[model samples]
Target chain A: MHELGIVFEIQKRLLAFAAGNGLSPASIASVVVEVGEASTVIPKYLLECWPAAMDGTDMEDATLEVEVIVAQVQCKKCGTVYPYLEHDKICPSCGAWECRMVTGQEFNIKEILVYEEDVPEDGSLGGDPAVR
Target chain B: MVKVYEIKQRVLANNDSEADALRSELKQERKFLLNLMSSPGSGKTSVLMKTIALLKDDLKIGVMEADIDSAVDAQTIATTGAKVVQLHTGGMCHLDAGMTRQGLEALDTDGLDLAILENVGNLVCPAEFDTGAVKNAMILSVPEGDDKPLKYPLMFTICSVLLINKIDVLPYFDFDLDLCIGRVKELNPDITVIPVSAKTGEGIDEWAAWLKNEVTAWRDTSSSETIIAKNKEYDK
Candidate 1:
């Protein structure tokens, strides 16, 4: 499935991101991703492939967090904004045929949740990183 | 220790940039790339074969058939005497812009004025991907019914040309052509719809003439700056 291919691409990029941040892959608790509603990506398939793609890798136990961005379209003639699928391009208000897509079609890594230990101002050997 | 990192990076940034780069390369090479996407059994090969027959004398043509398995389509296209190559997606449903680049490299593009990528058959995935083509064209056969535009609006939305294939079967199939074209135009304000049938060779000349015009126009404006002109529509 294409989603599996996309999963591998995301995983590869995530590993690079983790390395750039000087953090071990295991330090990532979850990788949050935002997928557009109109993007042809099936979230269910992506979730199904995530664990399989991460197996035996540094992110083996990491969770895959998904966020769906809704598709929005604005009518160029009527200046009305609505769901892209609802009206596509024809404005529901003025019956115009021109519109601009404002959102959706996005696929990106939004954030990375990491597990880390906090150190005290004195550089204590045993300070819980969670304890700011 | 735990902290969150905000790395808001596009997952397909590599694909977008690669597609842009490929666009520039195609312009520099004087190649007019056209990606054809349609559902399986939509006569994409038939249309392309007919196109080859019609334009072989006037234009140098090359084709790349993308499929998950088998080289049947590529073999069929090869019979037309045009330079052709087959691309295997290794189970991927769609060919991303990166994959299309690999296919271009494999095909003999030297002195070819028109190169067409018969993209994987599935309508949904192909529309979501950009193959760095100067123009995007898709085919919708009459047998598929007119309701397809409602179901697969994204395909109709992104395509600049919608080839309504199998018009010969219009009487056999209950297809409303006007309704279909109207729905498609609503999604894409600037789409040119051509009704044709590869079986009867009806409307093939018009399609060929359209291709000739587009090909020469692409070559005339071949430049790195105008390579991504279509994308500039969104930048506004």
Candidate 2:
């Protein structure tokens, strides 16, 4: 439900980043994003919201790459860390309910892949210098 | 040739910063904004009516009701004679800091001591985005079951106060109050849990007292840093 808003936010940031770097929106190859398993942001929903967010932005052809981070929780009682979903919010090692989430609630933009045209070594702005 | 830009930034960072800025702005205006969230049919409107009845005489209160599409909540809250505004999220499930700011502006909260933003009824999306409120609260009615904390950990974790509403119906339902509070505490150690029945007015005094104290304390404090620091302490 919230994925549409998130996609718009990502698109806004991408626009600003592209502007700052002097890159065209079409030059962007793929946008990489990392989401934690516990972040409540479903990667599937983000993917579904991507096309609508990119529509009319001139970057609809660009791809969205989503990377999910597994959720881990650290037991406060026995100082043991384990995967959260595997143990059901309990310390797997100590069998205790007291535990702190160490990781998983993360939503970040990792990087952007852009295709830059190769320029000739003679300082001339040429189209595909290697092809010539 | 492909060039990579290693921009490792949080997707919600922009919203977070905007929330912080709105917090500071509200602090400067001496308005204590409270973002109330819950699932649908959680008696949020009923609780708001009761709360307004209790504290409206003591403080200048304004309410901004956010819904995907509805003016019903605004109409209900208008009966209390307090300032009220209805905000349509335009099909969005949650209200971000920007939308909250726009709502506040529409309400014209100049000298109000408390501005309550009744967020859209959804446990997931609202908790993920901060509405720039001084505090976050959610209501979990007995009929909603006690295992909600396990299902919606982020919602349980982000809330500063958890109001276990519909206590009057506890005799009919199989909800375990102790186990529910325990589960919530496991997720958030510092959360204040209050069991209230908005219908019979049970525990409304304590909830109203808490809000009154928060509003008064916020006005007494001169520095915005103190408020931010205090909020940050429980928000973690």
Candidate 3:
């Protein structure tokens, strides 16, 4: 349910971003979102809801690209930071139980891909002026 | 040609900022807000009711019960004579910071000592969003098994306190309290895990007293002097 909610939120931001950047909505090719390993958003569910979330929006045809962020935990007592899934929050070096997450909770719109603007070939360079 | 612009913005940025505002506002008012999370059927509502029933007389308490549907829990809290409100999430599984702030605003906190936000019962997603409460707690019942910390480690990691509810059923269930504690403490060394049974009131006093202590500590730390100091920073 939160995935769909996130989808809708992304749609709003993408649309506003498109407008604010003075870019046409048609130029947007894909919206890349990073799904952290421990984040609430389920990428598969978010993609499932994307079509519905984008319905009638300017980004209706924009595909969503998901990037996964691996969870990393930093042990407070020993100052060891490591992948959480690997160590399960225990510092391998010091065996400390107190760890705070430094990453893997992020849910972010990582990037937006758009069609590059077509360059007009008729534009003359400094050496290709009318005199040339 | 295709161009990629790196946005690198948090998907829940709106909620995050709103949560910050709510956190500061609650602090300024010298009130304590607790966000309680648990899996459905973990007795979240029952624990809340018991806490409110035991603490309402000593503290000006308010509660916000959020469910996808039904006002049943709200009805239960109302009987305790505390200010209560029920929020229907319209099928939303979680309540974000903005939604929580709205609920608190509606609960009439003008002289309230403490407020509890009983989040929708779902262990996974609710732990992901910061609801801007001063303290966060979760309930794990004996029937849910001790493997939860290993299975859903994120929830165990995020909570400040863990309530192992339905302890009265410990005799019936094959729950090993030591194994559960060991697992959770491994994940969160600083967590305060309180074993309680809301049904039999076995540890309700301890739970209520913990809440009172937290509330008092929060209030005492953010006295008028601290607010003035904060105001000075704003002015500067």
Identify the leading candidate in terms of TM-score: 2
Top lDDT hit: 2
**TM-score of each candidate?**
0.86, 0.92, 0.82
Give lDDT: candidate 1, residue B211. 84
Error of 2 at B168 (Å): 1.3
lDDT of 1 by residue, A25-50 (tens): 77778888999887778799999999
Error of 3 at B180 (Å): 0.6
Off by over 4 Å in 3: A19-26, A70-105, A116-132, B223-236
Cα lDDT tens digits, model 1, B18-93, are 7888888887788899989999999999999999999999999999999999999999999999999999998888
Each model's DockQ score: 0.43, 0.45, 0.36
Q: For candidate 1, what's the RMSD?
A: 4.6
TM-score comparison, 2 vs 3, better candidate: 2
The candidates, ranked best first by lDDT, are 2, 1, 3
Model 2 gets an lDDT of 0.87
Query: What is the Cα-based lDDT of residue B224 in candidate 2?
Result: 79
